[model samples]
Target: MATTLFFLLFFTPFLYSAAAPNHNAPQDLVRSSCINASYPSLCLRTLSSYSGPTGTPRDLAQAAVKVGLARARKASTYLKTSVTGKSERERAALSDCVEQMAESVDELSKTLSELKHLRGETFEFQMSNARTWVSAALTYEDTCVDGFEGVDRKVKGDVKKKITNVAMVTSNALYMIRRLDESGGLNR
Candidate 1:
């Protein structure tokens, strides 16, 4: 009985370890990390699709900014190519929205760059900059949608839908950055 007990004790750990989920797996790390995001499911979707490291808050924040940047770029391209306003006002709004999307892309790129090099004594300052840039990116996205307010219903709907998706993603990125700041992950 003692031998059997010892064998169980020794093997049990191995069995459990083998069966347990890998917390360090990139997807799992992103999933847990995105739980506090404003749009958790969207955060999961965007960050999971990114083929990058996500082992730390900084890594996750960087990945998120990358995703947001890509989405903003796509939206900007789509606005430039696919959208056309039937009326002059609609055209103006579309123009303004396209510009805002471009600005969002630029801000997200800056945020990703900042997040990538966060270290040393400037870790907190770098994180703050990243958060601010991401926040600006989200703001640009929101402004893009706001420009569509007086547009034709169909145009407004279509533009709002597209910009709103980008905004949500950017907002999630901002949330991730904020969570990183609050986590004090930079200190470690």
Candidate 2:
């Protein structure tokens, strides 16, 4: 009886610990959610930094927008003041790109603030607006890229890389927000 008791006690924790490692639990939520995204890898990589066991789809979406905002802001700043040695047309295009990127940053900021005002039935409506704004931000970034065309190839390449990264992350944020609607993030 004592030996049996010893075995039970010794194996109980081991059994429990063995059962605790659920591979599906850690990333299943994020992976499944990101599966619908255009850039699933980028979505996962950008958002997994904010992942937690208890994080809901809403939280993930918010974190994505925050990351997008930071990237857009940094890109805007770089375009505004850093690049040099440009022709007249190149300088004009660079200036316009910086302005549009700043606008994109503003749109993302509005999205986060507006999320706090959503109601249950209207949650999708609010989310739609947010998604539209995000889309617009991407459009703005596209316009910025377009402006860079026919300019200095080197300068355009650098600025394009930065803006494009911001656009990709914003795209991920929009998809995450869409996932929120499916996950019942609208209601209290």
Candidate 3:
């Protein structure tokens, strides 16, 4: 009984350690998947936050879009609050950025919806739409930054920094969507 207890205590940790990497296999997949993203580190950071299934390209694509949507929403709230205590021009720019972020959120929502319902018969068509919407979301993010031009330097810098972060995440989402498309649209 003493020998069995010693074996159980000594070997249990080794058994758990051996299985630990398999538990982290999903995170490793996320890391490798992010390697090709425009913002690889951000992609890894954002998608790694998802505790859902990440065993397939579709799963990763959905996670990316969801992360982008959440960021866009948060940015919109920040922009709205930032409109106060700004010059008139800065206020205008912030207002435009708010609208652009709203559009971005809408596009990302549509992309997420499409990703969730990707059927084999219409797989190509759905993927094309998803890519188009994600690309449009990225464009809207870029336009938000463009609106900040000619505003106060500090305001422009602050707004640009926030918008750029959102844009990078959205761009990463687009990359994931394209990767999903190239992965044969859910067949893998």
In the order shown, the candidates' Cα RMSDs to the true structure are 3.2, 2.8, 3.2
Provide the clash count, candidate 3. 0
- The runs of at least 3 residues in candidate 2 whose Cα sits more than 4 Å from the true structure, single-residue gaps closed, are 18-26, 51-54
lDDT for 116 (candidate 1): 70
Q: Against the true structure, candidate 2 has what lDDT? A: 0.82
lDDT tens digits by residue: candidate 2, 14-48: 99989887865536777777788878888888777
What is the lDDT of every predicted structure here?
A: 0.82, 0.82, 0.89
What TM-score would candidate 3 get against the native? 0.86
Best by lDDT: 3
Error in Å for residue 98 of model 3: 0.8
Q: Candidate order by TM-score, highest to lowest?
A: 3, 2, 1
Show pairs that collide, candidate 3.
none
Regions of model 3 farther than 4 Å from truth: 1-21
> Going through the candidates in order, what is the number of backbone clashes in each?
0, 0, 0
